[model samples]
Target chain A: MKLHTYFRSSASYRVRIALQLKGLPYEYLPVHLVRGEHKAPAYASHVGDALVPSLETDDGHWLTQSMAIMEYLDETHAAHPLLPADALGRAHVRALAQMVACEIHPLNNLRVLKYLVHELKVSDEAKTGWYAHWARSGLEAFERQLALLDAERKAGGLPPSVFCWGDVPGMAECCLVPQVFNAQRFAVNLDGLPRLMEVVERCNAMPAFQSAHPSACPDAQ
Target chain B: MKLHTYFRSSASYRVRIALQLKGLPYEYLPVHLVRGEHKAPAYASHVGDALVPSLETDDGHWLTQSMAIMEYLDETHAAHPLLPADALGRAHVRALAQMVACEIHPLNNLRVLKYLVHELKVSDEAKTGWYAHWARSGLEAFERQLALLDAERKAGGLPPSVFCWGDVPGMAECCLVPQVFNAQRFAVNLDGLPRLMEVVERCNAMPAFQSAHPSACPDAQ
Candidate 1:
C-alpha cells in the first residue's frame, strides 16, 4: 500500500495514526501542499480533489477523505477497530469525529486561510482572531459534548466505559488529538475541559499517536 | 420517532430524505435556527451541540449529526439502505458524501457565513464570493470523482451502475442535492458536470428527494 500525504496536513495525520494503530505498513509518498504538488495532474488524477492522504490499496484502488479512509481500514483490517460494534456507540463516535472534521477543521484549512488573506484581503490580526474564534467556540461545544457523555454515564444512561465507546478509542480520539493540538498551538483556553484534556493526554501517550505526530514525519520541517 | 429540525437546514433536509426513503413515520419538531431556538437549554440539553436535526428515536435515544443519524437509520432500519454492502463501495460513497457535507457545506453554513461578515468584517460581496468559492471548488472536485467512476465503468474497471454505489442513491446523492441547491443559489457554474446534473435531476424526480426539498416543507418561505 502507498499513502500520498503531506506531513503537516491534519487530515493526513489522522490517516497516519489509524495506519499505525492497525500496524499496517505503507510507503509514504509526500505530496507537498506548501509547494503545490497536489495541484499537478498526476497527483490530482489519483485524488480527484487533489487532496493529500490518498491511500492506494495493494489492488490499486485509491481512497480519498480521511474519515472514509479510516473507516475502510477499520472495516478491512479489523485488528484495531476504530468504531464500536453497537449502532448507537458507532453513532456517538462518528458524531464526535464529525464535530472536529466537519465543523472545525474545514474553516481553518491552509487553502481557506490563504483565501481569507489573499482574496478577501483580511488583515493579519483579524485572520488570527478568526482562527482563535472558531477554535475556541468549536472546542467549547466539543467540551460540552464530552461532559454530556460523562454525565450520561454517571446518570446510568450509558454503560461504563474507559473510552468514547466501550474500552476502545475510536474515531473520537482520532479527531480529538489533532484539534487539541491545534487549539494549544493557537493558545485557546483548555480550562474547564478536564475530561477532554484527560482523553487528549491519554491519546498522546500512545506510540501510534506519537509516531503520527506531524513533526515526526519525514516531510515536516 | 421525532426529528428536531428546521426545514431550510441542509442537515435536516438530508435526514428528511433518509426518513422518507426508508418510509419511516416521524414527527417534525421545528427548532427555529434563525430564532436561536437551537441554543435554548431544552434543545441544547438534548443535543450537546446547538445544532439542529437531532433525531429522537422511539426507544428514547437522541441522535445528533445528520450523517450519524442517517447511518443509524440505515443500520437499525435497513429496508432501504443508504450505504453499499461492500466495504470499498461504502468508502467511496462516504468519501463523496463528506466531500460535500464536510468540505463545502460547513464552511458555507449559516453561522460561519454570519461570522465571516460580523466577526471578520468581510464585505457582503466578499462573503458571497467566499460561499461561491467553496461551492465551485467542491463541485469541480465532485465532477472529477464522478468522471473517474464513469471512466472506470466504461473501461470495465467497475460495474456500470445507476447511482454512486448501485441502484440506491446512498449518501452521495443525499449530500449532492443540498449542495446543488446551494450552488444554484450561489450561481456557480454547472456547465461541466453532466453526470452529476443528470443524477441530480433523477434524484429530484423521486418522491423522497422532492418531498425533502427545502421549498416543499411547511416552514419554507
Candidate 2:
C-alpha cells in the first residue's frame, strides 16, 4: 500500500494516524501542496480531486477523501477498529469525526486560504483570522458534543468516555488530533474546548499518534 | 423518527432523500437558517451543533451530520442500503458523497456566505462568485471521479454505472442531487459535467427524489 500525503495537510495527517493505529505499513508518497505538486497534470489526472492523503490499496486502487479512506481501512483491517461495532455507537463516533472533517478543516484548507488571498484579495491577517474563527467555533461545537455524549452515556448506565467516545482513541480522535495540530499551528484560541482538548492530550501521548505527527513525517520541512 | 431540517439546506436535503429512499417515516421539524432559528437557545441546547437535518431516533437521541445520520439509517433499517455491500465499493460511493459533503457544500453554506458578506465585507456579487466557483469546480471533480470509477469498473469486468455507482440511486445520489439542486439554484454553470447532470436527471425522475425535493418540503418558501 502507498499513501499520497502532504506532511502539513491535516487530511493527510488523519490517514497517517489511521494507518499507524491499524499497525499497517505503507510507503509514504508525498505530494507537496505548498509547491503546487498536487496541481501537476500527472497527479491531477491520477487523483480526480487532486487532493493529498489518497491511499493506494494493495490491489492498486487509489482511494480519495480521508474519511472514506479511513473507513475503508477500518473495514478491511477490523482489529483496532476506527469505528464502534454497534450502529448507534458508529453514528456517534462518525458525527464527532465529521464535526472536525466537514466543519473545521474544509474552511481552512490550503486552496480555500489561497482563494481568500489571491482570488478574493483578503489580507494575510484576515486569512489567519478566518482560520482561527472556524477552528475556535468548530471546536466549541465539538466540546458541546462531548458533553452531550457524556450525559447520554450516564443515562445509559455507561461510564464516561476517556477519549472522544470511549477509552480507545478511535475515529473521532484520529480527526480531532490533526485539526488541533492545525489550530495550534495557526495560533487558534482553543480556550473553551476542554473535553476535546483532553482527548487530544490522551491521543498525543500514544505512539501511533506521536509518530504520525507532521513533524515526524518524512516530508516535513 | 423526526428530522430537524430546513428545506433549502443541501445537507438537510441529503438526509430527506435517504429517509425517503429507505421508506422511513419521519416528521419534518423545520429549522429556519435564514431567520436564525438554528441558533435559538432551546434548539442549540438540544442540538450540539445546532445544525439542521438532525435525526431524533425512536429512542429519542438527536443524531447530527447528514453523512452520519444517513449511515445510521442504513445500518438500522438495512432494507434500502445507501452504501454498496463490498468495502471497496462502499469506499467509492462514500468518496463521491464526500466530494460534495466535505468539499463543496461546506464552503457555500449559509454561514460561510454570511461571513463573506458581513464579516469580510465582500460584496454580494463576490459572494455569489464564490458560490459558483466552488460549485462548478467541485462538480468537475465529481465528473472526473465518475470517469475514473468507470475505468475501474471496466477493469473489474463490471458494467458502467447507471447512477453514481450502479443502477440504484444510493448514498452518492442522495448527496449529488441536492448539491445539483443548490448549484442550479445559484445558477452555477452545469454545461461541462454531463455524467453528473445525467445522474441528477435520473434521480429527479424517481418518486423518492421527487418527494424529497425542497419544493416538496413543508417549509419550502
Candidate 3:
C-alpha cells in the first residue's frame, strides 16, 4: 500500500495512525499541499478529490476520505479491529469520531483557513480565533459524550472505558489524537476537556500513535 | 425510532432519507435550528452535541451524527442494507458519501455561516459566495468520483452503476440527495455536474426521497 499524505494534515495523520495500529506497512508518498502539488495534474487527474491521505491499496484501488479509508483498512485487515463488534457500540464510537472528523477538522483545515484569509480577507487574529472556536467547542462536545458514555457504562455495570469506548483505542482514538494534536498546535483552549485530554495522553503514549505523529513523518519540516 | 430533526438541515434530511429507504417507521420530532431550539437545555442536556437529526432508537439510545446514525439503523434493521456487502465496494460507497458528508456539508452548515456573519462580520454577499464556492467545488469533486467509479465498473466487466453504486439507491444517494437539495437552495451553479444531477433526478423520482423532502416536514415553513 502507498498512502498519499501531507505531513501536517489531520486527515493524513489519522490514516497514518490507523496503519500503525494495524501493523501494516506502506510507502509514504507525500503531497505538498501548501505548494499546490495536490492541484497539479499529476495528482489531481488520478485521485477523484485530489486530497491527501488517499490510500492506494495493494490491489491498486485508490481510496479517499480518512473515515472511509480507515474503515476499509479495518474491514480488510481485521487483526486490529477499529470498530466494535455490536451495532450500538459501533455507533457510539463512530459518533465520537465524527465529532472531530465532520464537526471540527473540516472547519479548521488549511483550505478553509486559506479561504477565510484570501477570499474573506480576514486578519490573522480572526483566522486563529475561528480555528480555536471550532476546536474548543467540538472538544467540549466530545468530552460531554465521554461523560454520557461513562454514565451509561456505570449503569450497565461495566467499568469505565480506558479508551474512548472500551479498554482498547480504536477508531475514535485514531480521530481524536490527531484532532487534539491540531488543537495543541493552534493553542486551542484545552482546559476543561479532561476526559478528551486523558484519552489524548493515553493515545500519545502508545507506540503506534507516536510513530504516526506529524513530527515523525518523512515530510515533516 | 424518533428522529430529532430540522426540516432544512441537510444532515437531518440525509437521515430522513435513510430511514425512509429502510422502511423503518420513525416519529419525526422537529427541532427548530434557526430558533436555537437545538441549543436549549431540553435538547442539549440529552444529546452529545445537541445537533439535529439525532436518532432515538427503540431501546431509547440517542444516536448522533447522520453518518453514524444511518449506519446504526442499517445495522440494527438489516432489512435494507445501506452499504455494499463486500469490503471494497463498501469503501467506495462510503468515500462517495463522505465526499458530501465530511467535505461539503460541514463548511456550509448554519453554524459556520453564522460564525462568518456574526463573528467575522462578513457581508451577506460574501457569505453567499462562500457557500457557492464550496458547494460548486465539492460537487465537481463528487462528479469526478462518479466518473472514476464508472470507469472502474466497466473495466471490471460489470454494468455501469445506476444509483451511486448499483441499481438501488443506497447510502451514497441518501447523502447526495440532501446535499444537492442544499446546493439548489443556495443557488450554487450546478452546470457541470451531469452525473450527480442525473442521480439526483433518479433519487427524486423515488418515494423515499420524496417523503424525506424538507417541504414534506411538518415544521417546514
Rank by DockQ (best first): 2, 3, 1
What interface RMSD do all candidates show, one decimal each?
0.9, 0.6, 0.8
Tens-place lDDT per residue, model 2, B1-221, is 98999999999999999999999998999999989999998688877888887999989888999999999999999878999899999999999999999999999998999899888999888999999999999999999999999999999999989998877889899999999999999998899899989999989999999999999999999
Put down candidate 3 lDDT per residue, B1-221, tens digits, no spaces: 89999999999999999999999998999999988999999999878788988988887788899999988988888888999898889999999889898899999999999999999999999999999999998989999989988988888888989888877888999999999999898888899789989999999999999999999999999
Q: After superposition, how far is residue B175 of candidate 3 from its true place, in Å?
A: 0.9
Location of the lowest summed lDDT over 10 successive residues in candidate 2 chain B: B41-50
Model 3 DockQ class:
high
Candidate 1, residues B30-68, lDDT tens digits: the string is 899999999999999878778988998887777789998
DockQ of every model listed? 0.82, 0.87, 0.85
Task: Report lDDT per candidate.
Answer: 0.86, 0.92, 0.92
lDDT string, candidate 1, A74-125, tens digits: 9999788898898877888899899889888998889988998999888988
Show model 2 residue runs off by greater than 4 Å. none
Best-to-worst TM-score order: 2, 3, 1
Q: After superposition, how far is residue A204 of candidate 2 from its true place, in Å?
A: 0.3
